[model samples]
Target: MEINIASGLLAALGHESRLAIFRLLVEAGPDGINASGIGEKMGMAPATLSFHLSHLSRVGLIEGKREHRFIHYSANFAVMDELIAFLTRNCCQGIGCLPKSFACNTPEGTSSQHGETC
Candidate 1:
């Protein structure tokens, strides 16, 4: 992921309501939850939920699909994975500076000195 994309994703997650909304969607998995369900779960007004959902969707953190009269929202896991990888990339540098456990935490079977799971 590019810096701009990462920054945008972070910015979308920066807001409290948006963060809560995103977290809820992630927990809901690929099937996602509808706008009303999200509002009910978050205790947000319909308008407020719509606004936050739009912001999250704009940043590619979430995706909305029309299912009849309701718009279902789901977490975009691919973008999320990209952001995670980008942030943790080159974490401890290639060296013998980290412990075994730390290296084990890295994703893709790679090891990081600080135990950063990419």
Candidate 2:
């Protein structure tokens, strides 16, 4: 991903609520979760959740599909992959640096996981 694009994605995730919302969607998998589900899980106000969701969607970090009555939102895995690759493009100066492998996410799981040290 280009620097500008990566920066924009990062900026969108900079907010605490937005990050939480994004992670929830990521763990929700490709099918995603609706705004109400997200609000309930995150305990966020509807208007606040809507604002964060809009920011995430605007940044291409998440995509929403209209179900019968509500929109189901899912993480844009393609864009997420690009962002991760860009962030770690120079991983360990092209070699291993960290001494330990780090789990990518909490028990819910995420898009990427590194089993070995980079």
Candidate 3:
């Protein structure tokens, strides 16, 4: 990913509400969740949810598809993966700095028990 693209994506995710929305969409997987469902699950008002969702969509972090009366939102995994790859492109200067047991802790500080070797 180009720096400008990565920066834009990062800037979009920088907002608290947008980050939460994106995280929820990521958790929902490719099928995604509609605006109403996302609002309900996040205790967000419809307008607020819409704002965040739109911001994510504008930055290519999320994609919204019209499904009849509702719009289902899903994380744009291609862009996400690109962002991840960009961030870690030269990790550890090509050395295997990340151990197999590297921890990706959750918000609660518990280890995810998942790791990727460099």
Candidate 2 local distance difference test against the native? 0.87
Candidate 2, residues 28-97: lDDT per residue as tens digits? 8999999999999999999999999999999999999998999999999999999999988888797754
Model 1 scores worst on lDDT over the 10 consecutive residues at 109-118
lDDT of each: 0.86, 0.87, 0.85
Worst 10 residues of 2 by lDDT: 109-118
lDDT of 3 by residue, 17-83 (tens): 8898899999999999999999999999988888888889988999999999999999999999999
Clashing pairs in 3: none
In candidate 1, position 55 carries an lDDT of: 91
Mark the regions of model 1 whose C-alpha exceeds 4 Å error after superposition: 94-118
**Model 2 off-target regions past 4 Å?**
98-118
TM-score of 2: 0.83
TM-score to true structure, per model: 0.80, 0.83, 0.83
Task: Order the candidate numbers by lDDT, best to worst.
Answer: 2, 1, 3
Q: What lDDT score goes with residue 83 in model 2?
A: 98
